[model samples]
Target chain A: MTGYLVAIATLVGIRALLALGLNVQWGFTGLVNLGVVAFFGVGAYTAGLLAVAGVALPAAWAAAIVASALAGALLATVALRLREDYLAIVTLGFGEVLRLFLLNEAWLTRGANGITGIPRPLRSWFPAHYDLFYLGLVLGCVALIYLALERLRRSPFGRALRAIREDETVATVAGKNIVRFKVQAFVIGAAVAGLAGILFGHYLAYIEPNMFVPQETLFVWLALILGGSGNNRGAILGAVVLLGLLEGSRFAKDVIPFLTGVRLAAAQQMLVGLLLVVLMIKRPEGLLPERAP
Target chain B: MAEPLLAVRDVVKRFGGVEALAGCSLDVAAGSITGLIGPNGAGKTTLFNVVSGLTAPEAGRIALGGARIDGRPGHAIARLGLARTFQIPRPLARMTVLENLLVYAPDQAGERLRGLVSRPKTIARQEASIRARANEILRFMELAPLASDPAGTLSGGQKKLLELARALMGDPRIILLDEPGAGVNPTLMRSLVARIRELHARGVTFLLIEHDMDLVTELCDPVIVLAEGRRLVEGPFAEVRRDPRVLEAYLGVPA
Candidate 1:
């Protein structure tokens, strides 16, 4: 039970990191990125493939960050000319295309069989103390990212992003390089998502194309919005609450034997959907509204 | 005997079937508060748009300080020492009044991503100066009391003042104000006018677009009038008010 609890905490930490990435893009800069999972998948695949090929974990991690950021920059340049809703559609399509590519590319990604036996760092040093060690490591990463984002939130750079989010024309007249800033923001968020992906892939010791579906991106968005879009702590809080609700539903199956498998899964999803609707109707700004700078 | 600080030459802008700016040209002399006036559809704002790089012209050349800026982006034009304010006053609504001003400070070290982390001392020093400068500007505009308030919470006139203060933060050599007096109250309007006069006296050039003829007459010398997307008359407000063409443009017949 203790091991299981630690594993759940680790999952929550990973989700928190994902939520933070979305918070930076959708919350801070108001860039509606629907292809967040695509960046995550790129990072996971890049790191996984490199690790499989005898590359060191540190080197693979760095490469994964670069690859995902490049992907984000490419997407921004190609689709950012289309504003708002149109941009959302383009990004959504990009995620679908990326997942399909990964699914079909048997030679590189092993098709749907998925990559297994992915190495975990420091797993051998503390064999009995593995889960706690990993939990501590993941929490440390989260702390670093949280601190960095908090610093950025209070900086002049963050103010400019909010300024751009409010009115691009006004930001332009005030001498902000809108395109440059937008691309930079997209890349930064993508890099963070990539780091989260690396952590998730190593922890799972396996990664499949199916793991990065649009539904996964939707969950991250839900977490960020539920916590509070612009507030970093809200992003983390939303992830914890969301994960608790999701994992807590496992007991529903034990309590009611009839609610099993697909039925139980469908019920959980419906609950989440209903929660989103209620939140949108009552507290659209989320539980912790964005703080004014 | 001196070159105009800003010049727009024969700019043409068409929207589908309607021409908003057709062969419009004007020049603003350095250190002068030039007024721009026109009827509802005389293309005053359109010309400002073309000059400020908000809207690309079909045919025209816009120059600021002898350098062509029409084809450049809005921020590029701003960096070249040209700044503008929207008639509707689009403040960074979520930010505090001080943040709104600080956000527009050109080329701040902290604005760079690396600079934010790499040079903390330099960023802190720069931020201190910006905060000090913002507070001074707030006091000068009589907005000191509301400096900590969200810009969205300010009254309409205060928003206008904040908008002007934002442009001033850019330290632009030339400013294009689109109807600064339109929605402001009388007392606020008087203070706004005084602020403009003070800025003008300090050698900041202004090209103002206004429907308030009273303001034009009082503060403007060398007022430029646009009628049907073309320069109709250009002279002192006193002389332009008497021109048959100007009167015909405004009143639909010679006065």
Candidate 2:
């Protein structure tokens, strides 16, 4: 039971980190980035490949973050000028393209077979309580990220982003380089998402193109909106609750023997969909709405 | 006199088949409140857009403080001490009145990432001064009581006042006011006029677009008239008001 709880907690921590990144893009900066999975895949593949090549964990993590940040900067440079709907389409296309590249690049990503035996740092050191240690590490990182993001949201840089989000023309006339700030937000958010991917790849100990789907991006968005859009703390909490709903439904099959795994999975998805629809209709600002700066 | 602070020369802008700005030219004298007036579709806002770098004119130059600024971006022009307010008053709506004011404070050291984390004391000191200045501006605009209120909650006239207050935060040398008195109540309009007069007295130049003839006649020194995207006349408001061309521009001649 403790091991199962720890696994759920670890997944929640990872999702929280990803949702925080999306919050910075969609909530604070008003950038509609629908290609978060692209950055996630970049981080996971780069770090996992480096690990397979015998690189140290810290260096692999650093390289992965840089790769994802560069990818984000490139995307922003090309598509930040496109307004909301067009940007969404462009980013959605980017995620699929990156996944296709990962799937086709057998030389690096090992194609459909994927990369296995991706070592987790200190896994041998804590064999008896590995899940607990991993959960602690993931939660620790989530807390640190939360603090850093809160400080950023209260700082002038964050204020400038919010200004651009609320009124680009006003921000421009007030001497804010809207494009520069948008790119900055995108890079930072992507870097954070990359960090999450590094943790996620190690936690799974294997990665493939199938794991980094557009559906993963949708899950993070659902968590962010369910929790609250602008509040970082809300983002973290949202992840825990939404993931609880997802993983908890699996246990329902155990209690009711008549329900098969496939039937339960479909039922769980429908419930989550219904919840999202209700949330959008009733509280579009989210559970924790963005506060006045 | 002293090289007009803002000079727009023969600026032309077209949208598809329609020419929005047809070779419009005008000069705003330094340290004076100049008025720009025109009938609807006369390209008054388009001229503002051209001068402010929101729209690039297809033909001609805009020089601010005697340096060509036509092709630059809006933020670049803003950094060169030119600021403008929108006709609809775009405030950072989710922010408080004070935060809205502080966002426009020019070149804060705290705005940079490294400066925010590494130079904590310096950022705090700079932020303190910016807060002080923003509060001071709020007080000047009679909005001190609403400093903590979200900007979007303010009434339309109050939003306009907040807009004007925010423009002052950037230490701009010249401010372009778009329809400042258009939707304001009489008492607030008087206060707006008084504030403009006070700022002008302190050597802040203004170029205002106003439809209120009373405001143009009472506050403007020289008025520039645009009729069908062309300059109709230029002189004191009273003289231009008497011009037959200006009269025909506003009230079309009987067919």
Model 1 stretches with alpha carbons more than 4 Å out: A82-86, A256-258
Considering only N, C-alpha and C atoms within 3 Å, which residue pairs clash in candidate 2? none
lDDT of 2 by residue, B108-221 (tens): 777787788899898889899999999999999999999999998999999999989999998899999999998999999999999999999999999999999999988998
**C-alpha lDDT score of every prediction, in listed order:** 0.89, 0.90
Candidate 2 regions with alpha-carbon error over 4 angstroms: A81-84, A256-258
Docking class of 1: high
Query: What is the per-residue lDDT of model 2 for residues A112-141, given as tens digits with 9 covering 90 to 100?
Result: 888999998898899799888899999999
Error of 2 at B36 (Å): 0.5
Model 1 is docked with a DockQ of 0.83
Rate residue A259 of model 1 by lDDT: 96
lDDT of 1 by residue, A92-175 (tens): 998999899889998988879888888998788997978899999889989999999888888888888888888888888888
lDDT of 1 by residue, B1-255 (tens): 788899889989999989998888889999999999988899998888888888799998888889998878888888888888889989888889988898888888887998987899999998999899989999999999998888889999999999899889877898889999988999999999999999998899999999999999988888999999999999999899889898889889757
Give the 10-residue window scoring lowest on summed lDDT in candidate 2 chain B: B246-255
